[model samples]
Target: MGLLGFFTRKPHERAGFELYSAAVGAARRPGFFAGLGVPDTLDGRFDLVSLHVALLIRRLRRDAAAEGPKLAQAVFDAMFADMDVNLREMGVGDLVVGKRVKRMWEAFHGRAAAYEAAIDAGDLAALEAALTRNIWRGEVVPEGAAARLASYAQALAERLAPQAMADFTRGRARFDVEVPA
Candidate 1:
């Protein structure tokens, strides 16, 4: 409510950006593009980021601490803000930026829902299907590519589950799960 409030951010806001940073880094790891077969194009990269962010959000929402939901929302806001900046930087006309971001948000939402349901069901096939549909764009993927990505995601979730809520709130995200080559 003060003038400085405009200049400074809340702790959760910083934590959310940190978490988003981690997700972007994880998505850029070469293992995904070379080993697991995600395409290296812009859309492919965006999908990978979306997938990682979705996983992180899912983890946060399940946190035992009440701060989980608030942090999760922060992460979501940070994502769209970054996307908006990215679009403008890419020379997208301002008139279309909102529409583009809206479409991206819809894509993110669908991917998140599908991944969540599959993970909750413990169904690797369903996960693979979702990955193939979204990441691979329904094309015939390289052999076992989608399956490998699904395995990696499941393992990453397992790794994320044990991290303390405090680590996230302190902007110390840990996303070093081994990607199955």
Candidate 2:
């Protein structure tokens, strides 16, 4: 390591940021709003983003790569960093930014915990319940909407499970990249 190392981010940090950007892209897919009826409001968008990011972290943790945990932590940090930037961009006052970010951080963790637990258990019904609660705040979704979203999440997780760690370390988001390397 050298002084330049001090000035620039290490590869893992960049990879994490890239991966988080990918999650955001997945969350923004219009099907969620138009078909699935995701609220399209700020809170709704935030929940979707959190769901995708948690999925990535969960997938990363399942792999045996030596970098997996580091990458997962980096992904988590990148997400909150993004939240902080978004808050500032939205003109949130500096004095309350930390508090607001904290609340969001807690919210993400709670949702992530529910998501991870349900997925790990292979309990689609549990996942559906959690998704319904988080995405719609227990309001009735169009019939079968939660189930459909749960299926989508499960499919994405499976799609990601066998992905090469190389794509991730290279800062090529495995889930969202449009071109082959």
Candidate 3:
């Protein structure tokens, strides 16, 4: 088994694994990677990428516990941040990057649609299934796509990990205290 195998081996881990994998695969497309300014040595950063993925999972899990539409929005936001870094670092065209961003947007909307369907049908199992599927299975991007996405995710994860870890360790922070009347 390989490093990716660790991600694929556990069904429970598949959702988060595939989420980052899809972004990586998307960024690795010929025009995509070329447009993004990705170099040829992304594989060198695999370990760091793994750390980002772990952080992404942690963030997602934390956000999911919150009420309202924020959870989905946070997921979408994270995806965008990862995509932005890829495009910005690679010096890709705005048009190309925008197209890629739309693709990501659609993916999140699709996820929401699935979640809504499950909810409308009152099938919690379906929601769980949709949320857990390995969406990136059999997806192939250009040679370095996975690495690019992983690295991007890692960088973003690194940015968030300090705060994210604090949240994990200290539990959720309170923004407002109730006043006794």
Off by over 4 Å in 1: none
Candidate 3, residues 86-128, lDDT tens digits: the string is 8778887877888876765565556555644654465655644
Alpha-carbon lDDT of model 3: 0.42
Q: Arrange candidates by lDDT, highest first: which order?
A: 1, 2, 3
Give each model a TM-score: 0.96, 0.91, 0.32
What is the C-alpha lDDT profile of model 1 across 1-181, one tens digit per residue? Answer: 8898899876599989988998899889998888877888889999999999999999999998998988999899999999999999999999999999999999999999999999999999999999999998966688999999999999888888989999988767788988778
Q: Which model is ahead, 1 or 2, in terms of TM-score?
A: 1
In TM-score terms, candidate 3 sits at 0.32
Sorted on TM-score, highest at the top, how do the candidates line up? 1, 2, 3
Query: What is the C-alpha RMSD, rounded to one decimal, of candidate 1?
Result: 1.2
Cα misplacement distance, residue 87 of candidate 3 (Å): 3.0
Backbone clashes in model 3, listed as residue pairs: 35-92, 36-90, 37-90
Error of 2 at 4 (Å): 5.2
lDDT of 2 by residue, 20-97 (tens): 998998888888887888888999999999998999999888779989888989999999999999999999999999
**Which pairs clash in the backbone of model 1?**
none
Best by lDDT: 1
